[model samples]
Target: MIGRLNHVAIAVPDLDAACAQYRGALGAVVGAPQDEPDHGVTVVFVELPNTKIEFLYPLGDNSPITGFLEKNPAGGIHHICYEVDDIMAARDRLQAEGARVLGSGEPKIGAHGKLVLFLHPKDFNGCLIELEEA
Candidate 1:
């Protein structure tokens, strides 16, 4: 099942600007930008006391974020990530409940280098949900 809230991902039109806003304006601890080719996103993490904020930018024209940005030019909350003890078990349970998993329905390496899977937004009340193995 789900564990702690891993991070909240936000799609950004400008990753640098977003990181600057958190680093300069908010004085938050911002991590270096990392490109996740599998996910097709360049991400930066803003660390918080309890959780983290992820800023996502399109890696290429074919990136999934590109489509998201096209629909929402200003960008918005892309997804909410939750940690799970066993990703396969969680996926199976969710599937039994008729929840659809995004992509190949297999876990992929996330920004944290952990196993991660994304559930369909429509299945989770319009909010994309990411389950990362804890």
Candidate 2:
């Protein structure tokens, strides 16, 4: 089952500008940008008192974020991540419940270096959901 809210991911066409908005305007503590080749995104995390905000930018032409940006030129909330105590168990239970998992249905290393899996947006009321191992 899902645990605490891990982070909310926002797709951004311009990483620098988004970072500036969060760091300068919002006065948030922005972390360094990290390129996640597996996820095909360059990310920067804005830490907060309770949770974190992730800014996602396309890393390559084939990046998923690129497609998302194509659909939404201004970019938007890409996904919401929730922590799980046991990712595999969570996957199985969700699968049995008829929820579709995205990709290979296996956990991948996420930005926090933790195992993560993405569920299909259609299965989660049009919002992509990410489950990260806690």
Candidate 3:
């Protein structure tokens, strides 16, 4: 049902500055920033050995990331994404196993050109879970 840890997303207030800091301080090569309008956030990816790190920022006030940053202040981990082979199957399996989904029972276009769905944190030991199908 799960393939690998794709990336750990972190919410940030300024996307460019965050990318610069990661590149300058950690020598991380940042990928091109992507704006996911449907999700109301822009993201920059930093490729790593095992998994990538995604920096997220709200596109507008209604964006969910905005609320996240508000509560976290210094910003924090948004969610952990796990790559999956089949999103529909995975959703069914998770639902049967009693996992709570955050949106409609359908995968949406997510970062890195993957189909993604989020499982409520309450169902995943306090961690917001993202299932991505490449």
lDDT agreement with native, every candidate: 0.92, 0.92, 0.88
Please provide, for model 3 over 41-73, each residue's C-alpha lDDT reduced to its tens digit, 9 standing for 90 to 100: 888889998889989989865898988988998
TM-score of each: 0.93, 0.95, 0.92
Which stretches of candidate 2 lie above 4 Å from their native place?
A: none
Across residues 1-134, which tens digit of lDDT does each residue of candidate 2 receive? 67899999999989999998989999999999999887789999999999999999999767889988999999999999999999999999999999999989989888789999999999899999999999
Q: Which candidate, 2 or 3, would have the higher lDDT against the true structure?
A: 2
* Number of colliding residue pairs in each model: 0, 0, 0
Q: Evaluated with lDDT, which candidate comes out highest?
A: 2
Worst 10 residues of 2 by lDDT: 59-68
- Please give the RMSD to the true structure for each candidate, in Å: 1.2, 1.0, 1.3
Candidate 3's TM-score reads: 0.92
State the lDDT at 12 in candidate 3: 89
How well does model 1 score by local distance difference test? Answer: 0.92
Q: TM-score: which candidate is best?
A: 2
